[model samples]
Target: MRPRLHIPRPHRRGFLTAAAGLLGAAALGGCDRFAASPMGQRTLKLGEDANLFVQRLLLTPASLAKEFPDSEISPWFKPNGTIDPPDRAYKALAATRFEGFRLRVDGLVERPQDLSLSDLRALPARTQTTRHDCVEGWSAIGKWTGVPLSEVLQRAGLKPDARYIVFHCADTMEYAAGGEEEPETDTTANPGMEARPEGAENQASDSQAAGAEAPADEGDEAQGIPVRYYESIDLTDAYHPQTILAYDLNGQALPVSNGAPLRLRVERQLGYKQAKYIMRIEVTESLKRIGDGGGGYWEDRGYEWYAGI
Candidate 1:
């Protein structure tokens, strides 16, 4: 059964005024200071517990939002996070329309395989038009088409030790902590700042330019090396019928910015968990070894790893 998404309508001025007052108090009371101390960790843990409690009180389980009809869908669906890929390999793939792109499925599986776009398309497919909710307070609805992740896993033959699936992406975000570039490599292996196209480089120079572009729309058919943005979910979510490796939207191939060729669709969680530009899928028992011992790049910076809502 599809879960019903209950979005409370924005309250009028009275509610806003009251909420603002509370926010003002928290700000004045040294919210940042409390957030930085050991006491802050305890406070955050308590707050998270409260948040989960209140969320349960207000919204239905995400599993209920899984069912819907084609006629009722959101018209303007927006993409969230990492709209443009910065990796040179991804750019080159994008330039050629991802014709040579292949998705590598390995790790704790009986048959590690390198699959092309056509290979994935040939598998049994499923489509769903669903709402994507982000932690940053935005939402959009779009149609997604792809094979059930279960089918892929079954074909690959999961090893008994496989417990979590990890996504490795090509879309590397700028981590002020020197980003993902290997410290040992010199400029030769690393395409210096000079490697970027003139227009893209200019865009990188302007802060506003970064967020100006939205991800590709649902129907974009342009080919290129698909961008690299990977995400992962636990085995429980992996086998859900609603969880898929989407390749189409609005009855067409996914656009470049929208994760052309393939992207993950874990409907139970927030949008960030739904990784795009997926080139590889790895199955493992623990996330302790993946980026920074935190599960995900953002999680390393303190965002909750299990963002259930």
Candidate 2:
């Protein structure tokens, strides 16, 4: 049986206090409306760039996120986005306990390869207990175990021009119903390096076509179109000692609700930056062509791309 960490308290008031202070400063200084205008967006972009520079400047290879003892692990680490992917391919993998899953690591890397779950576990691993601060203003602490991202990057061998590490995920955010077709099938549980779903492109165009918004009706959701979830980070965070592709949570094989198979644990960033249900890690020189041309799923929707905390 897999081991499970017994967390007495899910919320650490003390840690939350410290996290709040850190986040208040790191949080975007501008409001949504302020970021809506061309000039305002430019200003916010500059602010984001400045924040990235300062954070990177202060961060050292030796510097790490605060790690807690077993006693401090939150009994309940709230699962973020698409707790369980509804995609047919993902469900098939989950049904068989992901025995057929293969994590594709490609893009600008010189030696592209597909890593099995066993392949990842065979590598040197790191375990860290860190707090997860969310952009939604909540926090939780959890213990994570997995191979450091740098290990895989080194094994694959980065190309000289590689600039960013993009995580392609198995979770699809939008899918249209009725006669609309599902995403092209790949026999492997993990998705291959394909373009975003057509629905996702249309959604992007539609949203861009109209800036005005109607207040959301309770429980309303767009149906039938498929947009896969994805996120990215620069080589700096990818190589950070604390950065890992987590396969276990709180000493137990990660539950479906908590990103089974693999998920990113970039401890220094906000919760949204930790892309779950990860299927591929693409080393890229630019973020321009990925999902709405932003750095991440949330980032494309106006959340800051850096999201450092």
Candidate 3:
């Protein structure tokens, strides 16, 4: 059945906000040593599965997140996570107002594309005023404008085997030694997206568009390479009407602190799932090869992988 797209009613919106707050608190809290243990890990996984199952049962795949009117837009929308990326490539692009930036879409697709901001703007776009629920127990509403992720996927022509869409971003979570930052590198050597356009630099653009795991070591080796922020969603959510690559926020170009140039707005999920500074979109069959094999940067840190609300 095709998923229906409809704005959630006021009463239901209140219910969803409360429900999402409770879920985010329970799932995204700080991790302790217990969470790192094998037994505790299994227990957390069970909880995550229960949460996922319950949400799926309650909400249809096409269910739209509650949208608010412009009057209700938050006066101050707090930016969560890294506000500015320290990577050299990102800075270079930002220096030029992201003129040379391009969003690389590849992996498990018949046609890999490097879409510029103008290219994304030319595609069909959807705008919505929705609430952002951060796991830290804060909520805010803002208007967002961007291309539906489904449109981009259709343009790229997803392969039959594609099961998940992974978002590659520019924000570096961990820096190398001496505070030096490494340029963002595509996690995989997938031949499909390896080639860049002529004159394209190694960095990640603004039409508003939209890393590593290392072994522990006693010495400088512990620093490892810079690990950029990343998140993923199944094809179901990726195709949802509310899921978009947002380029504008609150009726203006998105601010850097708010994920300028581009960001992912997966409305049904918590804020952490909405990765900012998105540079590439990869359609993959599995998450095993990404970031400690845990699906996302936070997921590797013991957070729930499927944090649906």
Candidate 4:
């Protein structure tokens, strides 16, 4: 049964603001040490524990973030994070309008799933308008539609050992070295998608139209290659009623700039906490095994993992 495509918008309301800049900056200043040094790592662990305990203790587990009335929606909701993913595979999927895209749910599951775009949209879909508060002193309200994360997990048959849900995306943040150009996009790689128009520049136009501007640099790894972008949340937020794998923005198909095909909208937290361009859902017993022993790309860069609002 498809959940309502348009749940009645909630009453216009305000959400409490959290002071995340100072704390997040502090942790980020020493993010590498926070993960590398045994003492720093222990401190981070303590901080995460403190954050989780305090948030759960202070509020009901099912309490939801405020959902705004449709009248309150922002006319131009900005897409701040990775607007365009430079992956050849992802570009091919986008070229085809994502008919070939697949959302893989794996790791520590009774039945792993490889769901296509249609498969996900067919499931119950929930739409909500909510404020997205960015740590960088900005906010916007958007209506997001997708399957509740809990529903997907239920279908996956998660194991008791699962503690965190990791969102793997197609984007990669690679710094451009002084003179090296980023690799050109491969527009014709996937025969599934129609051939790119003359000089379309890989997936650039698609992403730009979708609200993302492709980077000018080559962004190739030989110059500077960082890990792929990813994020994770504990079971608590992962199972929240408002937490969803958002696929549509303001009733239309999600834009490439806004993490086309799929993204996560965990309403209770700050903006960066929402992962975009999601490709896979990996259930794991702990974050230690993931990249750099931190739960997310930003976490690996020294930002705190549990960013509660």
Please estimate how well model 1 matches the true structure, expressed as its whole-model Cα lDDT: 0.64
Global CA lDDT computed for model 2 = 0.72
Give per-candidate clash totals: 17, 7, 3, 6
lDDT of each: 0.64, 0.72, 0.74, 0.72
Q: List the residue pairs that clash in candidate 3.
A: 101-205, 209-261, 209-262
Worst 10 residues of 3 by lDDT: 201-210
User: How would you encode candidate 3's per-residue C-alpha lDDT over 112-151 as one tens digit per residue?
Assistant: 9999999998999999999998776667788999999999
Model 4: CA > 4 A from native: 1-48, 175-226
Report lDDT (Cα) of residue 241, candidate 4.
88
Candidate 3: which stretches are off by over 4 Å? 1-35, 176-224
Error of 2 at 23 (Å): 17
lDDT of 2 at 188: 22
Better of 1 and 4 by lDDT: 4
What does the lDDT come to for candidate 4?
A: 0.72
